[model samples]
Target: MQVPYLLDVLVSVLLLLGLFFLLTGTFGLLRLRDVYARMHATSKSTTFGVAGVVLASLLYLRYLGLSSGLKESLIVLFLFLTAPVGAHMIARAAYRAGVSLWQGGVVDDFKKWLDENR
Candidate 1:
């Protein structure tokens, strides 16, 4: 068994990374020029945040050898799968609602991609 000190440091580092994701998500939501950008920020940040926290919990539980129901595992997997879809839907809805990209947005891959999809 690894020492508690090492586990404590690991948990602390994980928490810091989680906090970084959360703050960046908030900043992106505020500073980004368009809804699509906002969605991209939130999707990427929150998925990682949720994954990190879930992984930490999973590790802690397993380290103690608890008979957990694997709920943490499920959460990590669920977020990983769904976050991108949710972001895509948000971007699509924004596009349909006529939210334009920022000035100098330069490339509209999503626009072209959507055009191709339809």
Candidate 2:
């Protein structure tokens, strides 16, 4: 039926999109000049990437009459909740430990904040 065909198309698109973002995150992790930039890239892109893949899985499972994808939904919820917070903690620790930004970085907002708050 057309419904199944549409679902297939949507799942395929989500998978491809997820894979693209995952690849981009990996590339940024390898190629970026500094930790902060690497974290930013990986956290943002990979979160969305994994979300897309999980959503696709959820849809396919629903199509197959599986149990409503509660596990996949939880995974997405936890990933979104944790990834950015984890990245922030790591970045803050790195900054406190004197990890310098890339030479080409344009902003030092955290540094300014620390200075202002001190």
Candidate 3:
């Protein structure tokens, strides 16, 4: 079965973009100096990366006239729903446990909000 050139190219691009985000998230996890920053990098980038891969799979399956895109769509949906909530909870826990922000970072809007609300 011969795939169309455009479909092949789109799949390749999406896969590469997904790989790039995944690698960037990994690098940030290893290199970031603070828990919040690390969480930000991992949650956001990895979710997008996974979504990109899922989207590519959905596209390829649709191109092949398959009805399996629903699974991929659900995967993307679940990832999008969970990643942010998980990150927020982790950050909140870290903050309550007294994790320090990076020394070089400026501005703590959340802290200010907390202080104001308190």
Candidate 4:
């Protein structure tokens, strides 16, 4: 079966987009000063990156008439559902464990909230 030209272009674009986000996330992980900031960058970028890649896969698979893209759809759904929540949980745990923010960090809403509640 001949794949459509537009579909091919779209898949290529999505693949590139996904790769770009993944690289950005990697840079963020390496360059960010603190755990919270690094976690924020990695979680957001990785989720979008993986989503883009999976979406491209789904489109290509659908074009090839394979499995109706159900597996890819579920992967995207699971990523969107878990990434942020997982990041938040990690950040909360780090904060509770007394991980200090970067020196130049100014705002600490979590600290304020903790102080007020206590």
State every prediction's TM-score relative to the real structure: 0.81, 0.87, 0.86, 0.92
Q: Number of the top candidate by lDDT?
A: 4
Q: Residue 4's C-alpha lDDT in candidate 4?
A: 91
Model 1 has an lDDT value of 0.80
Tens-digit per-residue lDDT, 1-118, candidate 4: 8999999999999999999999999999999999988997799999999999999999998989886998999999999999889999999899889999999898888789889999
Q: What is the overall TM-score of model 2 with all chains considered together?
A: 0.87
Please write out the lDDT profile of model 1 over residues 1-118, one tens digit for every residue: 5649888788778877887897899899999887877887888998887677777777677778884838888888888888888888888787889889988588988779888999
The CA lDDT at 70 in model 1 is 87
- Compared with the true structure, model 1 gives a TM-score of 0.81
- Residue pairs whose backbone atoms clash in candidate 2: none
What is the descending TM-score order? 4, 2, 3, 1
Which residue segments of model 1 deviate by more than 4 Å? 1-3, 65-69, 109-118
lDDT (Cα, tens digit) per residue for candidate 2, span 27-118 = 99999999988997899999999999999999998888776899999999999899979999999899899999989988888889889999
- lDDT of candidates 1 onward, in order: 0.80, 0.92, 0.91, 0.93
Clashes of each: 0, 0, 0, 0
Name the weakest run of 10 consecutive residues (lDDT summed) in model 4: 61-70
For residue 104, give model 2's deviation from the true position in Å.
1.5
Ten contiguous residues with the weakest lDDT in model 3: 61-70
**Candidate 3 C-alpha lDDT tens digits along 1-118:** 7899999999999999998999999999999999998997899999989988888989998888886689998998889898889999999999999898999999889888988999
